[model samples]
Target: MLKLTDMTLHYGHSQILNGISMEARQGEVTCVMGTNGVGKTSLMKAISGTHPRSGGKLELNGEQLGVLPAHRMAWKGVAYVPQGREIFPLLTVRENLETGFSCLPVSEHFVPDEVFDLFPVLKQMQNRRGGDLSGGQQQQLAIARALITKPNLLLLDEPTEGIQPNIIQQIGEVIRHLRTTSRMAIVLVEQYFDFAYDLADRLVVLRRGEVMIKGTRDNLTRDQVLQAVSV
Candidate 1:
């Protein structure tokens, strides 16, 4: 559902992603794993238009995409749950979710029941301030807000980072359920090896902003991926 060819990104002048190329197909979890500062998060931002790529082609669902901003990308069916969760601390949980409605028609402004079904805690705390929630709850809120958009491509940057073990497992189960639906392509930027490995259909390892190793789960061994990311 998403493709990047020789993609590059820069913060002023220092390039973070160097000629990176990869594809994320519908109904598949394409896990991008690497050590810190390897541009895993930067790649996610580039794909989701939170940060525009400096060079190369970006195509989503077959159409070539230009350097559009984040909201525009959302309109194009891309949802990004960034590394920090980035929830509005001052806003209520419901209000935070309502923000996603900006990209949708007014008729579809309401949150889906399935969203609550996915994270029942959110439904219970709809009126709670975002900052008041625990880290794990906020993470769930971040993912839930993204799902509100009904995106074709979901860009998740480190959904497990700093989350509790139980919450991490819940997030994994949600990812698994999403994959089973064959609804959208998932590009997960993750550091937790076991969590990522268990859910990844395809693995794309990045080293210093370029793809170091990439293949299906059947083609790449666990030790190979672990070594590549560790190095």
Candidate 2:
């Protein structure tokens, strides 16, 4: 459903992504795993249009998408749950979710009932300020807000980064359910090996912005995925 062909990016004279090429298919999770400074998040920024690529082809369902700003990409069905879970501190939980309404028409402005179904805690705290929530709750809110956009392509960067174990399990189940029930393509940038491996139908290993290993779970051994990010 999404493809990045021969993508390369640079910040100033320093190159980050090197001829990166990958794809994410509907009802499947395509995971990007790597050591730090390997441009995993940078690749995401390029695809999500948070940052433009210097060279390469990016296509969404065969429609060519030139490098545009993040909001433009959002309008085109690319929903990004960035690394830091950047929810507005002062905004109430409902307000934060409402922010996604900008990308929708007036008729679809309200948050979907499914969002509350996915996150019951969020529904309970609709009137509470965002800053009052715990990190795990905040993460759930972030993902819920992204889902509010009804994206065709979901770009999740470290959804389990600092989450508690129980919450991590809940998030995992949510990811799995999304893949099973929806026709959306997911590009997950994750360092937690087990978490990524569990949901990943396919994996792409990045080293210094280049793909070192790319394979389906059955084709790649678990030790190798662990070793690739052990640096």
lDDT of 1 by residue, 98-193 (tens): 999988999999999989999999999999999999999999999999999999999999998899999999999999999997489999989999
1-231 per-residue lDDT for model 2 (tens digits): 898899999999999999999989999999999988899999999999998899999999879988899999999999999999999989999999999999899999998888999899999999999999999999999999999999999999999998999999989988998999998999899988889998999999999999998888899998988887785
Q: List the residue pairs that clash in candidate 2.
A: none
For each of the candidates, the C-alpha root-mean-square deviation to the true structure, in angstroms, is 0.8, 0.9
Worst 10 residues of 2 by lDDT: 222-231
Best by TM-score: 1
Give model 1's TM-score versus the native structure: 0.98
Give the TM-scores of the predictions, in the order they appear: 0.98, 0.98
Q: What is the C-alpha lDDT of each candidate?
A: 0.95, 0.93
Question: Which ranges of candidate 1 are over 4 A from the true structure?
Answer: none
Task: Highest lDDT: give the candidate number.
Answer: 1
